[model samples]
Target: MVNPVRKDGTLDPALSIKNRFIDISPPKVVGLSNGVKAIEWKDGKVIMLDQSRLPLEVKYIECTDYHIIAEGIKKLWIRGAPAIGIAAAMGIALGAQDITAKNYREFIKGIETIFDVMLSTRPTAVNIKWAVERIKRLLKERRGESVNRLKELLIEEAKKIHEEDIEVNKAIGRWGSQFIKDGDTVLTHCNAGCLATGGYGTATAPIFVAIEQGKKIQVIADETRPV
Candidate 1:
């Protein structure tokens, strides 16, 4: 569960869902008792679970440099629309922390460059573009602020994005569960579960919630073939 919002409206880094929800007791899935968090920040670096090795080995890759995050996204190390968006936002935050510019102008230019690289990683997910643009807008709004303050704000914004995603997923689950009747069978394709999104999932969230609500819903997932 996400912590209550702070008085300042910005999410508390200590209370952020990424810290409270992702690694700590994760939702259970058959065969994989341990839960997986696609992206997270720890020890002053961005840590991402290597999705390419799923169901075989759970490997985590630590990224201190933002460029590596771009490569990770392009190579599908982290997938799903919402997850991609969160990764992009966090990548921008990480990139901002590494800027050694002497002035705000140079810092803004450096951030813009990082934005472009992150946005170019995946074309199919509009969420990625949306998340990057959100940070870009924040940069524009705080242009007059000091570089260090702006970096802190960007990190906070990324955490906000992450926390909001978890809430959104839960709300999706709650609302969608209403439409599912007891004993209903659901058919799905590809991976849409806690592993795909911040938590819960877009398509599978309802199923999980329905079961929790005592609805005997059956789910069948298709084995998606790559094109």
Candidate 2:
């Protein structure tokens, strides 16, 4: 979740925790998740299309609710591994925003419910479950604090996970792109490109950026099987 916009239209600190670990410049917008808003991208941008709809509608739906986000994950709106993890984190944050409890015990129970709700969104994606559990662990440790405070912290932590992924991709691109020289014919499986991740696509991100930097590489897109 991108930091919730404050009254002044500035991103709140709680939303900016992800900025600490990475440099992300992709253009995005807000969508409603369960009545609470969450960050999503706009159309005609680097990572705008609902990738699963690729070569088809090119349509991108802004996910505002946890339910929608979860469905997106299951349906492959964002199919890549890193992208799924980021989406899962955002889903947890969206679910956690509605938790209301005055006492520690009740608050903990509230979070447990929220966690279960978010986790139920998808089952096959290990990264999705991992990210949700990560947030749940943090929420458990922060049970002593006010519920509102814990919500903010959990959302921020989730954002951090989303942001860190972009940096990780960049590093991988820098190192991996070097393996392919100009004019090399490379065969790739599946659709892994800019539209699949935050910064760049994994496995093929380095190849895309390398091409942009004037490094010549011929890519063979395989449509028959998984990469």
Candidate 3:
């Protein structure tokens, strides 16, 4: 879930939780479920689960303003590599929707400003840079388009990024699941579970797939200590 971090870089306990469940369910490509969606677009806003409150309270933060989205990413409200990218894309779209420029040049400048803000949110996640660049490229290609149309296109692109990430996760799960035998045990490190990706996850997807395929494989996750 996405819980806003305080000025001191700590999550506000009022907006976070203490205990959370370990969900290893296979990623759902369609429809909604109990599994946390790292990021989502709904009714002209970006909605994210308050991951800071996971395993206990399921809270969500909605962002109609791109600045809020940027803060969310900076504060680790919505994390995971792919998920961060998705959030950046959506944040760009949200920012685009509010552009009041009367000409293409002004609109492009506004978009660039938004891009710089999002890019500065985090320095480590390459996916965020990749997603932002994709959005920038798309915007450049549609430079002559009207601001309204460009906004629509940006929103669509953001949603596309979110959808493609889930598909990629599923593909990873499918390919990785093949290595598992009926009773093979799996081990994972860190938080590479569903909470750490757009869906499924890089490291935990196979285990979920195996369980879904009726395999009795077991999973042990190492909680990378010393936080």
Write model 1 residue lDDT over 1-227, tens digit each, in one string. 45568888887888754444321112444211245588877767889988888767889999999988899899989888888898898899999998988888999888888988987899778998999889878888988999999999988998899878878877888999899898677776787776677756777777777767777655656554432
Candidate 3 residue-wise lDDT, 1-227, digit = tens: 56568889997877653323233433532212345577789998888876766656878998989998889888877778888899999999998888899988989888889989999999778988999889889988988898889989999999999888778877888899999988776777876666667766777777777777887765555574422
Best by TM-score: 3
- Candidates' TM-scores? 0.81, 0.70, 0.82
Ranking by TM-score: 3, 1, 2
Worst 10 residues of 2 by lDDT: 28-37
TM-score of 1: 0.81
Candidate 1 — which residues are off by over 4 angstroms? 1-34, 224-227
Tell me the deviation in Å of residue 19 in model 2: 44
Quick one: best lDDT, which candidate?
1
Off by over 4 Å in 2: 1-49, 224-227
Scored against the true structure, residue 219 in model 3 reaches a CA lDDT of: 56
